[model samples]
Every structure is written in structure tokens, then in C-alpha cells.
Target: MTDPMILSGTSSNLDSLRSQLIAGSEKVQLQIIPQLAELGNQGLEVIQEFLWQRREQTPTPVDGKIYQLLYSCGVPEIKDFLQVNFPQGVVPLKSEQGIDYIPLVELLAISDFQAADRLTIQKMCELAGEEALKRKWLYFTEVENFPVTDLQTMNQLWFVYSEGKFGFSVQREIWLGLGKSFESLWTKINWKKGNTWTRYPNEFTWDLTAPRGHLPLSNQLRGVRVIASLFSHPAWDNKK
Candidate 1:
């Protein structure tokens, strides 16, 4: 079996380091991203802190995996990072080669999707459409309220979604649509019922099916299809 990796930093200094990273400037030393990446659970906690604090500077831009981490934490830095680094065009989130601004989502959620990286967002919005971006965000909030059962479940949930395409599937697209009309839909629907099996709480209940140790994006598409069906159901759509 492969051994779990441990970070080199001391436990005592961890908190201070994290606080500094969270509250510190955007031009943080490049080393911080890797250190936090290696820090295991400590690193994740720091990432959350950074998202919550919503620092407005250039966030530590690590590889895209870190961007996925930030997204799971309700941060999406894709648009902002693209604008700042490549003012000439849209930067899609792909493999390690793609620009991964985990910080962009952070800026979007905190600023109501008004990105500091205006150029990229403006351009991408044209390509992906304002609604696609809106839907992407909607998925974030909807997933956030999902009953995780526990912190461990929550962690597992993040692992599945961040690593696999299933998490980003069709359910997400539907949720994104829902996000555009969140206040209205959320107000009418029974949030209590949102936790039921059919609503997608089942993904966690079943064994993770990430393909050959990798997340399949198709799974995400299927999930959205499911969500769309539910929303379009006769009962759900007919409600006054």
C-alpha cells in the first residue's frame, strides 16, 4: 500500500503560518502553495480559511488541483486568474497546464460573481454564456447545503467531486440553472426534502465509482440530467 504523505512543517507553527497565509497579501511566496498542498489536513483547513477570509490579492496560484480544492471549498478563481495572467483570452480549467485560480471562485462567491478578473470573465461569458457561469456557481451553493452527515463524509464528498467528473456532472448544470433562480426556487422547495435519496444524497451513500482512480466528467453530466428530471417532474414544476 502507498504511504500517506506528511508535511514537513511543525505542528506548533502550523496555525501561525496558516493565519499569515490567509490574512497576508496575494503576492505570497510561491513556496506557500506547495507547503500547504503537502500539509494534508492542515493544508485543507488553511485553504478554507483563505476562502472564508476572501483575500483580494493575487492568491497563491498552484497547480489546478489546488483550484479544485478551492472550488470544493466554495471558491472559484478561474475567471480572475485568467484575466490577471492572460488579459488577452479565456483560460479553461483543464489539466496541470491550465490556469487554476482556486482564488477566482473565492472572489466570485464573495463578490456576487463580480470578478476582479473582468477581462477573462467578460470574454468567457461570451463563449460559455452568462447562464453557464451562473449555473456553475449555483451548483456550488446547492452542494454546500447538502447534508454531509459528518465532517468525514464532507471530506469524502469533496474527494469524490474534486477528483471525479461525477461531482461536476449534469446535476451540477441543473443546480447552476437553479442558482440563477435560487432565491425563488429555494424559497418554494422543501429544503428538508432536498436531503432525500433521489435528490442526489445517494451519490455519497453508494461506493465511490471514480474510474480507474480518476473522476469521470460524464458522471457529472449524468447527475445534472437526474437533477433536471427531478426539477421538471410534474409535481415539482406544477407547484404554485
Candidate 2:
């Protein structure tokens, strides 16, 4: 069902794929999106239908997933449809724990990253199990066991809506670029400067002006172990 090269747009196969896109599990939905994109407008029309149902009025996680995939097709109709329908933001949302990522999508889409960063922490905490959920700060052990799907979903929300300017994946890329040096990585992302931590709510840039991989601010004051856990998580390895 993931590959539909032989299936014409009008064929029942496309309908079945559409059904899969709507009702399939997260893994299935992710697989079918690329196949859906290959169908041209027929494919796009179904994508459009899938996304439209999850519009701001209704707001399902599926809308956020499709939103993240919107750039895959540069077709003028798709572009226009997105601009007209989802001016605020877009994506298909799913989570291992049935976590709602629509809030993160809306926050990112509208460029309200201050709130998005807060929600990002909340979402990650939720994924780390009930203790971390209540604590609202993750322990390294919890992070070591984090789900890649949930992390990728969160990273996609940040990456797509921010025009690729942010996300955990972004941070990880910079981390690796600095030879995996935490000090260098922190400095590169403006999280620290000359041994001084970046002051919250004032020094940090909420918009595009910050250094690359800057938003979704992690509490480095808690020290390196948590941020280290995040940068070293399997989630970054599975970002595709």
C-alpha cells in the first residue's frame, strides 16, 4: 500500500490508500504519504481531503502530518490550497501515547515559538512516562528510553513550521558538526556565551533571529546529562 506506482489516480487503489492515510496507525500513515504524493493531483486531492477534514475547525493530528509533507509537492494547486486553507500552519499529528501535537503545530505555524518551546518540553515529558510527565523535566534515564516516533513528530512540528530553522534534529546536527562537543554545541546554538547561560524570556530569541538550532530551549542548567541524553537519543538517527 505504500508504493502505488502501478495504481492510477482514479483507481480504487488510491481510495484504499486514502482510507489507510486516514485510519492507519502512525507507521502506516507515514508510509502511505510519499505514495500519496506520487499520484499528482489525484493523489494531492486525497491528501487535500485528508488535511481538510482536520482543518482548524476540526484540528486532528492528521492535518499536522499532511502539513509537514506539503513541501514534498511543489504543485501550484497544492501550494494554493495550503495557503488558502491553512494559513496559520499544517501537519499530520500522531504519537505513541496518542499525544496531541496539534497544539505544537498551531504554535509553530503561527510562529509563537515561546509557547511552542514550552509545549515541546511538556510533550517530551509526557513521552517519558508518568513520573516525568508530573515532574515536567526529564531525567536522563527517561530520555534514554524515549520513543523515536514521538520525538520525530515533535521535531517535525518544530522543523517544518520554523522553515527548518529549529528542532531537536537541528540541534543534533549542530552538535555533531561541533565534533560532539557539548560546550561547543551549546556555544554554537547560543545557549551559552563565555561561560554565561543565556537568560530566559529576555536574552533568547523567540523568532528567526536566533542562531541556528536555537529554539526549543533545553534547561542546560540542570546540567549536561539531560541535553546530552537528547542529543544522543535514537530519535535523531531516525529523523527521516
Candidate 3:
């Protein structure tokens, strides 16, 4: 792990160090990305502060590499920071159900769809709050339901980031088109084949080139109940 102090230096110094760290081989990036994230909120703050300082220097390759590192870190605080600070970067969207939402596109700028997908799920869990973990699925109730706005926000994020290649709305469209058959829906999303669920995090494609409806990731392989919980959510209902 690079010293936290290194990241706390002047913006130029931090930029130089970030360049050196990221410019190293892929193996180095793998090592450093996790270490940076391991620093937790402090590390995320350092990155955020640096990015803000360097905001004037747009379209730099270094920024791309740094954003990739941030997305790969999968820290919810980083996602929150990006969402709050770069509101314009996140595209506003509305679901067919008339839910207004916004997608976080700052991470998508890194072009790592797999990382974006993972981070999106983490962000959803964050938005869903503690009950989501207690319930073991994002269950919606009449009172303390999963916020439709947040769901739509995440869906839009996935849609815009993947160029309409993935999102809940995308999946919902395919689901309805296929008569809401989970089996066919799984196949359409490349999550199943020949009666076996696709292996998690391995067989899954990590690039934008993955099949349509392939994201806004649901951990259906966790069990059919997980899929049931996801599909049965009121957010999927088309009626406003």
C-alpha cells in the first residue's frame, strides 16, 4: 500500500505519484488499487480531493487511469462523492414506470463495465440502507420500501453507461417480451445455459461488448429466491 501521506501531498505531487503507480504494469495496478481502497474513506477522500483540484485539467489519460482505479476499488463512499460532485456527469433518466432517476456516469468514463457493475450493486446496497442486508434481498414494503428513485437511478446509470446494453428496464423489457419467464430471462442475460447458472465473476464478461441486458447485476446465482426478490420488486411493475 502506498503511504496515505503520499496521497495527502500537493496536488502535483499526488498526481506524479498516481502516474507512477498507475503507469506500472498491470500487476502493479492490481496490487495498488486494493491497497488504496483499503485506506477506506480517508483514501477515498484523498482521491476525491485530488480529482477536484485537478478538475480543470480535463480529458487527461491520467484521470482515466485514476477513475479506473476508483471504480475497481468499489468503495461506496467514492461513488457517493462522485455522484454529489459531478452531478452533470451523471445522466438524468426516467424508467417506464415513471420513476425519475440519475445514473452515475463518472465511473463509466473509465470504460470498465465490470467494475461499474459491481460498484453499482454496492451503491444500491448503500442506498437500500441496513434493512437490505437484514432482509437478505432488496425487499420493498409499503412503508420502508426500497426507494424507487434510487432503483431508477441505478438502472439509468447502467443503461447510460452500457449504451442501453444493460439496466433493470432493459431486463424488464426482455422479461415482459419473454412472458416473464425467469429461465428465458436468464438465458437472455447470458446468466444461464443448458440448465446451469453461469459461474460468478469468472465466466461473466467484464467489457461493454457483453450482451444486452447483461448488467445492473443481480446475484441470481445466490439462489432462485434472490432472483424472485429482484423480479418481484414493485420497481419492476410498469404501472405508475
Candidate 4:
């Protein structure tokens, strides 16, 4: 695993890396891609074949990694595949407060939905000011102060990477579509099931098959005000 993670690429290791990619743990699979890329065309050929194998299934975070790596590899065929299938391009990390959203983008790109969700909360708290960042949550008033550009940028990272399945904007759309009904929105996004709230970690679907707008979860536990403020945010008003 250590070798695959950091080794200089060589022709002899090409087949070995390919085999590791096919059967390796997610950690290995992800780490080995750079090693694979280091092998040049030989490495890229492996990546191309690997990507083709997963073309039918939903794109994973590894798919996002490949999308970025392929651009660096200078392969026309792979780049074309990216242009068609992953047209979201690189998500813009716009932030009025100069917050770094690259980590959020990276997590989303790898399809690490839960990590992204956690980071989403962190970023929102960051937007709310230092006290909120220290407390790790938001007051509804703080939500109103969130910069529209930052929110839209965060939403784009989640929305585009998740095949349009998730994001705060998607949640806002759901909220508006239901005539701004919060209870209905909860049920629709699977945040609640009948009388009971879905338990975190155990009940949330953390993947593409989860209900639409089910992710990038706002701090809904403090009641609907936070999410309500988020849904009502002017971020939705601006045209991208």
C-alpha cells in the first residue's frame, strides 16, 4: 500500500497497480491512481480501461479523481469522455470571506458525501462569524448574513458532483416546489419518517440512491429556522 501510494511509476509496476486498482480497498484504489498516472500512457491506459468499466454505474469520487487526473494526462479521448459525462467542469470555489472551499470540492468530487456534509456545516459556520465557527453551528440570524456567492459556490460543488442529486440549491428548489412547506420538505428529503426523525449516521443514506436533496444537510436539528433561512436565502435568486 505504501509503495502504491508514493512509488515512482515504472513499466514493471503497471500490471501490479492495475490489479490493485481492481481489487484494492477504496484507500488503495484512490492512492494508486497517482502511481498509475506516473507510468505515463501505460498508466493512463489502465485508468482509461478502469473508467470504461465503471461507465455504466454511478460516478464515484474516484471518478472525480480520474476526471482531474485525465486532464493532466493530456489524453484527448479521456478528456472527451469527461467533457460529455462530467461536464460540470471544475466547480468554482467562490467565497466572499476568502474561505477555502477546495477541501469541500475534493470531498464531493470523491463522492465522500458525509465528509462533505460535515464540511458544509463547518463552512456555513465559518460564514456565520468566529463565534459560530467556534461553536460549530449557526443561528438563524447568521444564515441571513451568508454571502450568496459562497452559498452558490458550495451548492454547485455538491449539485454538480452528485449528478444533480444533492446540494442546498436543490433543497431550496424542493422547498419552493412544495410551496415552502417545511414538514413536507422533511418527509420528501427523508430527514423525517412519519413522526420520527432519521437518526444521523445510521439512517441517512449518504450516497446517490438517497432521496433527492437529501444531502449537504443544513443544521436542521435546531429546528427549521436555520434551514428555513437557508432556503429563503437570496443565493437562490441570482442566476448562474
lDDT on C-alpha atoms for all candidate structures:
0.36, 0.75, 0.59, 0.78
- Order of all candidates by lDDT, from best down to worst? 4, 2, 3, 1
Candidate with top TM-score is 4
Candidate 2 lDDT by residue in tens digits, 61-89: 34545775674467787778877877546
Q: Cα lDDT for residue 34, model 1?
A: 47
Clashing pairs in 4: 61-110
How does candidate 1 score on lDDT? 0.36
Lowest-sum lDDT 10-residue window in model 1 = 210-219
Residue 77's C-alpha lDDT in candidate 3? 74
TM-score per prediction, in order, is: 0.25, 0.64, 0.52, 0.66
For model 1 the local lDDT of residue 155 reads 20
Model 4: per-residue Cα lDDT over 1-240, one tens digit each: 568645544645887899999999766877898889987787898987787678766545566566567755667887787677545545546679999887776676567889888988998888888899898888889989889899888887787677667878788888889998989998999998999888887799989899998997754533887788877889888836
Put down candidate 1 lDDT per residue, 1-240, tens digits, no spaces: 543342333564576667666556544523465467566666766654554344343222322234444444432353454345533211222322233343443443232122323322332232333574564422323333322222122122223223232222323333555673533332223221354422333232132332221221212323443335333433322221
Q: Candidate 3 residues 141-199, lDDT tens each? A: 42144566656566656664554567777877888799978788889888888799888
Q: Taking the candidates one at a time, how many backbone clashes does each contain?
A: 18, 9, 0, 1
Model 2 alpha-carbon miss at residue 152, Å: 0.4
Identify the runs in model 3 with alpha carbons over 4 angstroms from their true place.
1-87, 93-104, 131-144, 220-229, 232-240
RMSD of 3: 11.6
